[model samples]
Structures are given as structure tokens and as C-alpha cells.
Target: MITVVLPTRDSAARLVHVLPLLVPAAVDGLVKAVVFADAGSTDATLAIAEDSGARVVQAAGDAGARLSAGCAAARSAWILALGEDLVLPDAWRTPVEAHLAGGGGKPAFIAAPGPLGLAGRPLAVLASGEAVTAAGGFKAGGDPLKALLGRLRPRAVRLRI
Candidate 1:
């Protein structure tokens, strides 16, 4: 099972769009849990998260720190760290499952679909590691390419809508 971790601070509007996309994964048992490491929100972000069955943790710090905290709280062996504005593609389950089952220790980046049939930008990265060290070295301000290169095996997987 995998846990989807995201950091939110007054992200109610964004979650409205994102939560729906994640529900299917949860219902299908691919996503065991959703962790929202919130820094602080005056809005209904927490309310929405609870309503969606996500475990909300009190997180304090920058985006990277919040992400790390959320990841640390995850119960799954694999973790998918996603941006607030991103959404998983309809066909995400197959590829994700394949990657996990393939025993690829290297991290995989989910690509966002671009205009028309063009390539999209990398959105999220999935990895397997220790409770507090999953997706190693790819911190908020770290160099993604360098981190990927440092790994024993690196593979980039794109998720197109």
C-alpha cells in the first residue's frame, strides 16, 4: 500500500480539485491513506481534509519541512509526495502499481500532461525508504536531477491524463 502525502496551508480551494482525484485511488485500495501536514490554516482546509478521510497532522515549517513531517507520519512502505495543485491522472493506478511491484528502489516522477499531446512537466515523485527518509535528498529546494543521479537506479515515470 502507498500513502499520498501533501502539505497544505489554507488550501481549501485547491483541495476541492485534488481530493476528488484521489478518492478513486483510496477506494480501490491502492492508496492506504492521505496525510495532510498542515502548517496552519484559517480556512476550511482541515475540515475538508477530515471529511475526505485524510489524517491531518499539525506541521510547522516551510513547504519542505511540512512535506517531511507528513512523510514521516505515513504508514505505507511507499510514499507519493504531490504538490497541492496537482492531480493524478485517470490511468495512474496501473503504472504506480507496476512500479511498486517491480521493486524499483529508484524514485519515479509523475509528469503532468501538457497542452495537446506534448510532454508535461514532472509533478510529483514516488519513492521507497525509511520512515523519515523516503524520496531521499529531493527536498524542497534540492536539485532533483542530482538527487536522482545519486541513487543506484533512477527512472522517471510520467502520468498523463
Candidate 2:
């Protein structure tokens, strides 16, 4: 079972779109139970989650904190911290399960809010049930054409299509 921990603040609308895509037990016994940790949302975020059978936790503070709280609520062995602003994919279930089950690696996937490098296979990096790119070493700084460089990690270079 893969516990997908989604962190949100005022994300009611987006959750509605993201929720339905995670069902039907696509990867054998791999159940995708959702945990929505709301950062003191005044909107209908919790309600949306409740209606969708998601476990909701009342949270406080930033994205990382909310994600941490949600991950703490997760019951699965592998925890996936996702953003509320994003819509997760349904097709990813099979690939992630297959990748993790390989047992040949300890995967950590970090994703930016953009396309990955051409040399990097998208599914291998994004759908490996690992952390996303941003969690790896990249940062998004408002420059649409480039990733902000992090000194302690991989150098960020502007990629051209």
C-alpha cells in the first residue's frame, strides 16, 4: 500500500480534481490512501477530503510542515509527499509499484513544478514512488526558463527544447 500524503492550504477545489484519479486499487494490493493535512484552511478543504474518504489532519504552518504531518498520518511503508496545487496521476500507480518492488534501489525522487531534463527519463524519476526533484536539489525561482542553482547540490542549468 502506498500512502500518498497531500499537503494543502485552501486547496479544496484542487483536491476535488486530484482525489478521484487515485482510486481502483490499480497496483494489485497497493492501495492509495490519501491523507490531506490542511494548514488551517478556512475553506472547504477538509470537507472535500471528508467527502472523498480521505483522512484529514488539521495543520499549521508551511508546506513542508503540512507534508510532514501528513506523512506521519500515512500508514504505508513508502510515503509520498505531494502538493495540493498539483493533480497526481492515476497511471503512475503501476509504474511506481513496479519500480519500488524491484528492490534494487533506495529511490528518492524530487520534482520541480516543471518538466524534467531530457536525459532523465520522466517516469523513472517522477513515477518511481520516490521523492520529487525539488526534494532532490533543485529550486524554482520564478524564472520560467531555468532552475535556480543550489550550491550544495547538482548544478542547475537552463535547458532548451
- The 10-residue segment with the lowest total lDDT in model 1: 143-152
RMSD of each: 3.4, 6.8
Model 2 scores a TM of 0.64
lDDT of 2 by residue, 32-90 (tens): 67788788777998788778788988768665566656666777666555544544554
Angstrom error of the Cα, residue 83, model 1: value is 1.7
Which lDDT tens digits does candidate 1 get at residues 22-126? 788788888999999898988999999878889998888666667777888888987887764545566677777777787455567677667887756555667
Q: Which stretches of candidate 2 lie over 4 Å from their true place?
A: 26-28, 103-105, 110-161
| Top candidate by lDDT | 1
TM-score quality measure for candidate 1: 0.78
> What RMSD value applies to candidate 1?
3.4
